[model samples]
Target chain A: MATYLLLSTLTDEGRKTLKARPERLQEVNKEIEAMGGRVVSQYAVLGLYDFVNVVEAPSNEVIARISVELGSRGTVQITTLPAMSVETFVNAIKGGR
Target chain B: MGFYVVLTKLNSDGVRAIHANPDLVSAVAADIQAMDGKVLEQWAVLGKYDFCALVEAPNDAAIHRMAVEQESRGRARFTVLPAMDMALYVRLMGQSTETTGPHPWQIRWPVQIARRALRNYWIDQHVRAACQPLTVLGRENLDGLARPAIFIANHSSHLDSLVLHSVLPAAHRRFLTFGSAADRFYIKGRKGMTKQGWWNSLAMATFPIRRGAGRATLAHAEWLIDKRWNVAIFPEGTRSTTGKMSTFKAGVAILALAKGVPVVPVFLEGLREIRPKGTRDVAPGPVTALIGAPIRFAPATSVSDATYAMYQAMEALRLRLRAQRRPDGPEEAT
Candidate 1:
């Protein structure tokens, strides 16, 4: 199984209005963990948005489900991007496309 | 300053999640520090997220900005929380501090002497008035209780102590003093009845009990009792705002057993609904007091054993009082 990084942004609703609810964040974390995805790290920021959470899952599909779960809360918009290790990056660059 | 932690993970592709990007995390941390927030610690974790960063800011807003900056970087998410000092929290919630506010009895006092005179007069009058209405169930039990005793009671409202004070004979009242917290009552900048309560208590020979001072405060209480002043302790340590009795602390039991004083149990009812906790307003209501037969302390008992026994006896008395008040239904009793 391959590990995938899950990056998410709190929507405007989440950042400005729903940020006060610590229970919501707890619930989100619990849900992700129950689904076999690991929350490797999490941060609550204040610049452009409210929070940022880092997650690790087995596949892109798991990341997609995490994103949908966040979106369904209607508190924040989420965007997920797949990441690669330095070794994979080196190999891909060496393969010439 | 505010503290924060960031958790994130790396994806299958070379691109990192918003929470996991090293550059973004560093920039966000720098931004927070530049804005007067202090970054305490940042580390990578294996479980929930890729990394966790702890930062401290001047205010909540600054921390919020830091969280936002990290999010826009598209790496990870975060949760921020405010931390409280345990000592401060315990002190604020302890029984001694609970009574430092303006009580229903304080409105009549112009100064310390006036407060004492008024309290004496009111207790006498109220005790006389309550004699016919208030049922005396355990007086036979208290008869001949000559030794210095620790009077333990279920606190409901401001009137619990007042009513107890009224019922005790003038001699017992003279030797007896109730515990009140210094921080709440004697603090330098307090206003209104709280300050007045402190002064009135001092004038009435009520000594200050520092909350959460632990064994030291307990030692002071022992000294006062050993000096033969009957000390009335609210073992629940604070009044119950919900009208239901809270769990009693072991300090009362410890003091009682240590001093070899009889633990006199008193149950007060209908006081919470009358004045409620943390308020000065009094709503007219009939209040009742049931003084349990005093339990004697044996010399063989250790402080720990005595503390447990005290709690058991108190809990039994509380249950008895609850049963009396709600003889027919469980719903009426707390």
Candidate 2:
């Protein structure tokens, strides 16, 4: 299966938020799970961004939908990318394409 | 339970024969199972060995015995690896790597004077100065103790050790040694400051314990205690990642009982806020430490009974520390 990288950032509203509020992030995780995506890791940082999440999804469109749902929550901004494995890179190089 | 990774190499003839003989494969598996180990995985890989197997057994000796049995079967030479879990691996990584220079506490004769001054200035200007509201309780409990004792405290924050060490009187501090993990802190080739921190700890009489090798490490600890220096140990073995108490390892009780030393119970509050587990960042906050009366082990008490008594004493001390609350008050050293 193709792996899509899903990255999400907390919105200003979420940045000022306390962890005691579970509903906001819980809703986002549920949407990603429903789309057959898995969160590989998540980190709370002390910089320009509040939190960073690394997720694996089946396809770009699935990741886009997940990001849209997260953005609509008004608590985070999202970025998604199609991630390629080293095996795929090796195969492409050997394929002469 | 012990986790063992078994590496085996088969002669080309034996490999060909095993491929042709299902009975041979079953026989090998049966022999391993007979040694009281459960095979978790068997993998054929492109390496020197024909196959690798992961097994769980009662202990290291059982795993070693199984490896010997497998090799004697004349199919393959075998080697075993005792697996240290990932959590332990990460902790060891943190402890072994020295990211900075020799700590201010570890310096030569001439530089030692400057190091001590710098340490005092840093503690006074940074730690003590930054935190406006700090309180110390239970000082009398420590001063009242007349005999050599073991101070056991909950492992909450990294600052827990520093706070305890700082607040202790010079005489007591001279006699007291803190216990740290040997695999991490005391190892050579670590980074500068990390090495320094470990050196400082050693200067303060901190001894190192090798984790996971419980029985062997505990015996070493008993020997250290018998040397008659007052020692401080966080019985939980490791810092509590969560803000709750963890199960204390039996090493402390084993050492205390063998040496017949009194165990002094201590509790530190607000240290988690100052320096949370798994982080290098420090937060300014009010912190308090409470030292409870030392509990003596009865001469006739068995090791198990003394262990139970020690646990009870520590629990009671924790309760007292948690109960004390001063919303608006001056910081007092107890």
Per-residue CA lDDT of candidate 1, range B1-334, in tens? 3345434454543133332443444565567678777666554433444544456555577767777775565545565554332223233333232344323232223543564666646455644543335554566667788857888888766567667776676657656677765665555444575355556464444555666778667664676676676888887776665555555667876677667788888777666766776567766655667777787878887766776666677677667766677545334444
> Which one is best on DockQ?
1
Question: Number of clashes in model 1?
Answer: 55
Q: What range of 10 consecutive residues in model 1 chain B has the weakest lDDT sum? A: B100-109
**Predicted complexes: DockQ each:** 0.03, 0.02
TM-score of every model versus the real structure: 0.50, 0.53
lDDT of 2 by residue, B1-334 (tens): 5556555678766676665653465466677788877776554433344555556676678877887776766767775656544334334434433232223233234443543555555344555743546677777877766446788887777667667767666666545667776765667665586355455553444556777767666553565456555778898788765555655777777777768788887777777767776567877888777777778776777767776776677777666665565556433222
The runs of at least 3 residues in candidate 2 whose Cα sits more than 4 Å from the true structure, single-residue gaps closed, are: A1-97, B1-126, B129-131, B196-198, B201-203, B218-224, B326-334
Error of 1 at B288 (Å): 1.8
